[model samples]
Target: MRPAGKQPLQSLYFDYPLFEFRQPPELHGGDMQHPVVIAGAGPVGLTAALALAQQGVASVVVEKKDTVNDGSRAICVSRHSFETLQQLGAVAAFLDKALGWTRGRCYYRDQLIHRLEMPHSEDERFLPMYNIQQQYIEQFLIDKTADYPDLIELRWQSEVSELKNSADGVSLGINTPEGSYSLRGNYLLAADGARSTVRELLGLRLQGDNLPGNYVIADVRMAHEFPTERRSFFESSGNPDATVLVHRQPDNIWRVDWQILPGDDPDDAVRENNVRERVAAILAMIGHEGEWELEWWSIYTANTLCLDNYRHGRVLFIGDSGHIVPIFGVRGLNNGIADAVNAAWKLACVLKRLAPASLLDSYSPERRGATIDVLRNAGKSSRFMTPPTRGYALMRKAVLELALTQEFTRPFADPRQVQPYNYEDSPLTTPEAGAGEFTSGPAPGAPLHNCRLDEDDYLLDHIGHSFTVLYFSIEARPSSELAALFAQLYQLDPACCILRITGAADQVNEDDVLVDASGRISRAYDAIAGTVYLVRPDRYVAGRWKSANPEEILAALRRALGGSKP
Candidate 1:
């Protein structure tokens, strides 16, 4: 493990997972059927595979590329993504290698205009964000799949050339290093990427707008002490009339994104000579006298495109295949991770007969709702970063100009970081009135709070596939009533992991009781004695009540399972 602030072994591309086809049974004779098949081996696809594996469902992940991602794209991993990674059992490696930060700064020309701090305190398990290269993330996820070798089968250099979906399942024609083969699966995950073959074969189209502006991202290696904070500059003398972003990565590598004019030829913009010149000029502008080497460079346009729907029959789209948003607020990868978690749990439930197959239908609405939310949020940052029209550019200019002087205008210059998306309106969550005696924390459909259960334990570590009925009361342990409540809960879903939290710690028994040592959980959840919460597998607040009512809890639990009221 690379210790925090330690450099990694310098490398260009991540190591590949080689899968040799030596008399594979699926291809040797008849078509082999699997429970789930993932079409891409990127972070999202691999995460989906691992998620299914954790639920005891087997999956086959197919990847055209032989190795992890090339270069360092998507450098920012949001805290929400880290939570999902922890649930998939790949977060230990990530925490060791990732650069953690909680603050971001915005500058106009040379003056510091605004500073935004993400919510982080001693009570939280992880920080607001971590800056790790995309390749490293993919490598960590790949390492995790090895732990569940029987449950996860990773195929390298295997591309889905064609796919046909039906009422039963999806039929896929895979082209591999060995030869073309065929396989059938009960469900297919189209995490193939932005240029998805599954999407094309299915005759689906992404509908949205693309900004006219483009960004040249140059990853350079150098040693420096830049406090690991997100920094953005607009109309700076170093890179005059352009917007530049700087983020620090591990191994002494740094990623700088320079927004270029719309007229700049994409071909010439990515040239090494041009990229180096721009990078060098910006480095000098920032007063970095240290020597540096250009490692890699790429160009990307600010796009806010997504499918009209994320689900079609047995095929579910995830990651860039389903949506594309600006990278400024770090929503792209985070939202993709959410897609994997959301789909993984629901898919596993249906495949295991724990929930009705109709549960899968709710995925599109919930995730599509999330995608729309991302588009709406990222659209603001996209327009702010790359103003599409002259009027918008002038607006930004005025905002940046006033930000230098007026304190009130400084908020306008701040890049509103990604928010934990709420599914209050999702079909899966039980909607209810927020009116209650103590209404704090998140209501139904909101992302659950992550608090420190102990020095190394987290409250989220206990949330999973079953409905976790958090009986937050003043009881020292499971009361008789609570035992009966869980009896019904276990009958409804045996996967549930129950925990009791209370205001008293010393009075509680050690088994099945977690004392809110710091009262953060109770304060965060606005819980009093008898207050209870039903958290879904993805750790979203499925339903909460001021008091425990077995009938009401069971009714909401059934609703979360996509079944009618009992």
Candidate 2:
């Protein structure tokens, strides 16, 4: 572990020649011509590759690990992230093996403090969160990538030892089992884990500290009688030196974690018989004791750290390389997945010449801002889990006890506190006053609602293909001349897809401004009588306007297309 400071980089030295003598093979197909190369076969890298392939851009992924490790880490995926995966065609495989949880509870000592029933809508797609192992996500991504041919070459056992970047692209020196070889890519994405070799080589600085807390994580099969559908947390009894958390997986397996004192030897505490004793103690605490089998056990130190920047010229970082938050909120993996989705499309646009290079600049500010928000939220959740002092613990307990009441729980049910994020300051967002608000006239930065089009009941599924524009009324529709101009623009820009939703259509009345498939339009979007909304590829509202002014719409499109003159 290196200290937190600017350290001089060490030069690379090899005992043998860097590469065995061989002629460089000629690259094949437009896929191989991609400028970006991702190093790591983790979920973030695989998601990025999948996103790029879906957009018709190629990428190469190199992994030192030969196979995906079936460790049950990163077990929770958010609704937004699940939708993003579905867009890449990887969610079906994940859903086949995932566990859906619509309820969560918090316990303090012998009292149930907080209980939350997940949101349910007439639309089933937005129901519950999914829980699946991180490895499953990686495997699903790898399987779906077959459609892209050789766009993503997963060279197992290939390790990147050195990296060099210039104004053009990145040059990587990789050491493989056979021999060493050099790879040149227009861009490099570092989705490697926390101790990233790419970040170290680039001399990038991680911004936070490794907070003082260590815990032991164990995956075991317990033959005891306990609720398998709920997550349980137990506070320390009389002694603040210990705490326990248990999560039950869909496969009937249990994941148990116990907090360790500062001087505890984690390895010694995880002995076979010792593990059984700990399980027995926990079961006894809950008044159940039975036979149990241990599958795997390990210790980890929790830290809240983030990189200062997500991009440096052609080399970009995602996943743990960019930020790592406390696990209480289950935000780390979900945040990384979001980063991959955001970067993959921009990289594809740049490679295909559909959008200018300036589009890549949005990755850092948007993701970094989101990362900061995750840190703050995770920090709050962590404090709720492990209060700093006796007074804090008492306060937390009181709050949770109060939250058990219906009146208090109703306010806490607002998912917006967890789901809302802004890309308003992003370089890609158009500059308009009150762009961040949900106004009627075409203003940039309006979020996408789960809405529908005319004669269609499934708008969420249809809107996933590409960027979309929806008109709320027939009067808001662009004139024939403007429609023709937009048709040309859509022809030139393969990333933007347009759809119209109007009151003149079935199930809609003239009084209805914006009617979703389910006919539920809240005050969130204001539902103006005659207005149009422009959504980005990632589904954030980019621009909205009341008038069908083709020139204003074209100007907004130009700004979104990377600051080009319309």
Candidate 3:
């Protein structure tokens, strides 16, 4: 992937405006009622608020802190995440400041073992992933909230102290700098990070595997010419029987994660001196001898955990509050972003009365399924990066040895990265009649690819935040049934839209149409004339029909909105 529209940027934390703690009128006196009350202002909560705002839904964001995150929390934003940000109106700032990369190299004992290239093509707008600090991720989201002043309100230094869930709504007791307050919402979103107060109040517990291997992640600054790429070192002379990972970030900073020997205290590992020593050893091993300064450091053990359910009455959990997967493939925040997107759209539909309450029930299964899928892949990467047992360590050593010499073994060194999960079995999706099994292009429950629809924007810009009927009609004129189908969508979802795409300009009519002059959208969908695709508000294909039938589309729309097809 190639970087585009590169511009110099200052520190995201320093350059962006700091949010101030707004004094709320004693909510205990019943001063405010938010339709949606979100519990956290981190990346997940901020993204959830923005997603709600984009869908014309109002929300209140409660942050325990007055500023964005101060560390390089999550540095890799996947391509699908970029699309979601685009839908939520926060991608331009991210692209301007992030380091986009597609290639990674794996080394076993100083010998190149494998070179991995993620799926990237010139046709795509954003790179497969971008490396930016979590501070920027939160800052960009905060900045975008300004565009929807009426829709999103951020409450800084406000912590959720208590939560009461009922059939009608959820009431929250909040703690602020000024005084204690109370608030109520029709629905509550729990995005308060891994130590979620909402989850505690709901009495929900996460269950998953916990590995004993520990790792120390440090962010250091230095001037060097190494391009942006992920490099993993296995059992190097600098750290025998341990693995170190090097990832480049913006602002001349790099993220270094290395395994800590058993019985090493995590407190001692994050000490500046200990971190500097480890950085020096890895830097020397990687052939760098620059004067380096340690910026920040943290430590953690490998654990994969998730709640039994994501939704509880009027309260819903999102992001890390709902699940925690090993960070082997950068699935942590990326999956959290997916959570924000998924929950936001469904909440919008139910809030707008466009779907049944059962629609929101699918959020748990679909996203939890996604979390489990991530665990399955990330578990593999974790076992390789930090073997949990002696037998696993021996197997990894043997695998590394084979990868060093055998080309066939190199693919095992892949980090897999983050991919949008297929929701073929989602209750909200029509059962796939072999559509999800397709290898050529998108299947039902697959992600919609961005393609140049005209000289100005991509096809994805036309989809999202509402049900979309993408009817592939090559002719300039629309048929009566197509027009009827378009009309029906408005009745079903007021936010819904129909993108009438055609390769011929002469066939375009008064209904605003998109000209797929390059035929990329058609190729990406493998569509023909009269083919129709139903896209959910979250940009996943709900169903595809060889022909546009209004009744069939209406039935599919019902199923997508959590109603059984009649």
Q: State residue 419's C-alpha deviation in candidate 3, in Å.
A: 0.6
Ranking by TM-score: 1, 3, 2
Q: Write model 1 residue lDDT over 1-566, tens digit each, in one string.
A: 12123234335434434456443456676777899999998889988998889888999888888777777888889888888888777899999999999998888887899998888877678889999998888888888999998999988878888888999988898887678888789999999898999999999999998867799888888987789999888888778778999999999999889998877788887877788789888898777999987777778888989998899999999989989888778888888888998899899889988789888888988888887888887788888888898999999999889888889878776777787788888777776645665568778999888877676977887666556788887765467876787888787778887778877868555656777877878888887778888888888888888777777788888888888745
Ranked by lDDT, top first: 1, 3, 2
lDDT of each: 0.83, 0.66, 0.83
Backbone N/Cα/C clashes per model: 0, 8, 2
Which 10 residues in a row give candidate 3 its minimum summed lDDT? 1-10
lDDT of 1: 0.83
Clashing pairs in 1: none
Model 2, total clashes: 8
Q: Worst lDDT window (10 residues) for model 2? A: 8-17
lDDT of 3 by residue, 331-370 (tens): 9899998998899989988998989888899999999999
